[model samples]
Target: MNKGLTAKGRATRQRIVVATALLTREKGAAETTLDDVRAATATSKSQLFHYFPEGRSDILTAVAEYEAGQVLDVQQPFLGDLSTWESWQKWRQAVLDHYIELGQRCPLGSLTTELGKSSAEARAILTTLFTEWEEALFLGVRTLTSAEPEAARIRARSILAAIQGGVVMLQATGVTDYLTAALMTSTDPLRPTAEGTD
Candidate 1:
């Protein structure tokens, strides 16, 4: 969408996206409207169209991309390394803490449902996010466990699934137990054995 624009124009576009993201997080993507975005960003309809020619879908696609980055950002440092059990634990805690605090306000669920049918472009963005997330976890698993590559990959996918599932439950029930337990179970294998085996 940012094919050609001055730095100031890019900044203005980004400002709109960020504001829309905040509104989505607070009110949900399904509930959020172009009017809400306009009010939040103080942008007129023409300005919004100039920045996002496709209107709400385009802005939402951008926000989905941005929120996808945030999903990985919260698990950073530990997510980057995870070469040791300690680092994995730290990463686990970071994931747990983020979702627990977010509770029902988390936007992933709403984004998926809202964009799944609206546009292939939006769906692809989310697909990329999950792929990137799984690859990061797979790298960590490979580094920390001497298991076969395929096994490590499966483990990483399972862990990622656990997180997504737990978050779904957390959003529905407003309870952290589901997420907490899910992380513990999914990460248990990554912990070193008492015999110091990894």
Candidate 2:
């Protein structure tokens, strides 16, 4: 249970977060005013301030956390449990399909950019998100390769870096080839060796 939240409190917070997420996605972080959030969530100013004392920055931070969760949420069971090649493929497709559908506009990207990704708080949030995401990929890679766990961790970081760089290029160009190449190339080395007539 989340210690800070009563059931109703939790529900209200979720409503605010989801509403903020949609507004950010649709309007970009720059244009999503507190009034917009208030109207979208049907939340009173007092209630919004009660839940987030720091107002927009606080809500933006919370929304960033929410969006971070969402980035992987679409991958579902495959992202959670990647013990098989089939699961990896599914996860890959989910990630690709998600960005493809989203096109150049990325709510999460907008939020991070608006919040100053270089800031200590923003970096910390991103670090946590990437850490968790890389861990999931690391486990799958380890399972597939039977390598040292640490090796998998290193590879996972590399893979994550590649994917992030790819996503940046993708957002700039409205192209997905960079993302696809990043994932494919990162995992290419992990492909099992097979005997051939040579």
Candidate 3:
């Protein structure tokens, strides 16, 4: 169970998280200071501590989780239901469009990399995000074929790897070619075999 918090408290906390995320995205986590977050959020030092008692680390973890959610939220209806070929295509386009818009900046990746050095919690947050993402892909894969659960699980993991690889390349080159090829090749198996074709 969670502790009860007033509406205002929740709003304040959300404001802080949103402000912090924005700052981190723009300035990179290593350069963002508590004072920066406080000023941007219009929060006092004590108020910041009231929400994040562990200080900068705690706030960074919250921002990491928020960014993780954004990764999935952008996928939307397509990600939730990839049972059909059309759905898969839509999901791929959504992913490509998102990265294209984001260019080389990956908020979650930057946050985790910056905070992961000293915070086990930051690593755990990233692990949880990847786990959930893989599970979602697994479920979607199962819908496409009668393959065994293990096989579907493997395929899902490969798909995730492809996406990550693409993102990494995008970060390095500021190009979408790798990501586009990754999504296409990874989803190729999901397409139904044409009549009498293996």
Comparing 1 with 2 on TM-score, the higher-scoring candidate is 1
**Steric clash count of candidate 2:** 0
For candidate 2, the 10 contiguous residues with the lowest summed lDDT are 189-198
| Ordering by lDDT | 1, 3, 2
lDDT of each: 0.83, 0.77, 0.80
List, residue by residue over 110-176, the lDDT tens digit for candidate 3.
Answer: 6445544437777787788789889889988887675689999999999999988888777668898
Looking at candidate 3, the ten consecutive residues that score lowest on lDDT are 189-198
Candidate 1 lDDT over 1-198, as tens digits, reads 777988999999999998998887677777889999999999999999999998988988888888777888888988888788888888899888888888887766555655444578878888998898899889888877777899988999999889888888887789989989988999997775412863
Over 4 Å off, model 1: 194-198
TM-score of each: 0.92, 0.81, 0.87
Where model 3 places Cα greater than 4 Å from the true spot, the runs are: 115-118, 194-198
What lDDT, from 0 to 1, does candidate 2 have? 0.77
Error of 2 at 60 (Å): 0.9
Displacement of the residue 68 alpha carbon in candidate 1, Å? 0.7
Q: Which one is best on lDDT?
A: 1
Q: Residue 14, candidate 3: how far off, in angstroms?
A: 0.7
